[model samples]
Target: MYREVPSARVRGAVLWWSTSPSWTTPVRILPDGCMDLIWSQRHGLLVAGPDTTAQVGTASPGERYVGLRFPPGTGPAVFGLPAYELRDRRVPLTALWSEGRTRELDERAAYADRPERLLESVAAARLGEAGGPDPVARPLVARLDAGGEVARAAADLGLGPRQLHRRSLALFGYGPKTLARILRMQRALSLLRTGVPAADAAARTGYADQPHLSREIRALTGLPPRTLLTTTP
Candidate 1:
């Protein structure tokens, strides 16, 4: 079972937890322009970076995982590094923080009944020290997710194309163009989950057509639309 709740301690973040049953299945984690700080019963503490493609993950039966997912541009502030450095990777928390800090966090998580809350608290404290996420991050994501053209969005944000690209790399681990594509795919997937036909979902979400949608989905997820839906949360 899996569940997520909006984080009260950290703005624009979610706290989630999941437990594997006696039987295990591969989980498809799609790219959604976010990074996660995770605590696992089996793996200890880890960081999940933004992905350019879907990630296939599995767990030992009966294992539990708790995570705090930070929105695009929010993670760098809390993690104290550029988002691009961790893109498409999952690394031990010790890799990003000093052993002393990592060990303290591990102890806290081990003693907390709800480790996701601990993850959120840690993120909140770090983000406060960093003076919070970039002010442009939320607006940038909103503009791209709404299907605004990258150039126009940059201009609207009072940024030159190069400036936007550079900032995007640091904030989202990719350029605005790729982020837009991933956000559009997420929109299409949401529509599909609600029983929207593939063709209609494509058109509504700005794809050229059904085939265009199919191709994009397969490229990003390595699966057909139907298969992808079966694995989606």
Candidate 2:
């Protein structure tokens, strides 16, 4: 479904594309210090922010795209975690890269120069074959998806509230509650896009009401739900 090419410039840049049969939603590509260009079947093309989180889904036919991956060292600072963990955090990728605030990592991956190289490298890596979600993050993801309360999810995971906060801050750059809210908002967006009424979507996605959902949507995308739906691409 997705193909990656290695960088030609410095062997650090990689390019990739997803061309599968299934309707792909906007993928929430987590920022791991890598820059990417995503093309969707529905959405034409998108250049990601350094640390910004996006919802990627399958587009219509003929919707294809390319991405450029930066080398480990040269890449932006990415708070390492699944997409669900970065809720409500507005830290920029450039800020992280400039301050050297993240964990010591090789952000400059060989996908930096000449993204076509990513196809080869990604083919070799076989991301599809790399089975299973991250063990540590999976439970959290599941809990959020199931609409479990953050406090309950933490308890179920055998983590104390304070401990969960610490771990979340270290791994996700945000607290667990914030991440949960983000996941809920993403789900709400999907529902809205699919013709669900805003009031219903808000209740299903855990917001206090439509107004609450509106506020969050405005904060994240700088637009209200109606505006976003009208001009998502």
Q: Kindly list the per-residue Cα lDDT of model 1 for residues 1-233, writing each as its tens digit.
A: 99998999998898898988888778788999999999988878999989999999887899988999998889999899989999999999999999998999898898888787788778888988999999889999999889899999999999999999999999999989999999999999999999999999999999999999999999999999998887677
Question: Which pairs of residues collide in model 1?
Answer: none
- TM-score each candidate: 0.97, 0.52
Error (Å) of candidate 1 at residue 212 is: 0.4
Tens digits of per-residue lDDT for model 2, 81-120: 3333333343333333333521121132222443344333
Give the alpha-carbon lDDT of every model.
Answer: 0.91, 0.53
Question: Model 1: how large is the Cα RMSD against the reference?
Answer: 0.9
> Can you give the lDDT of residue 63 in candidate 2?
52
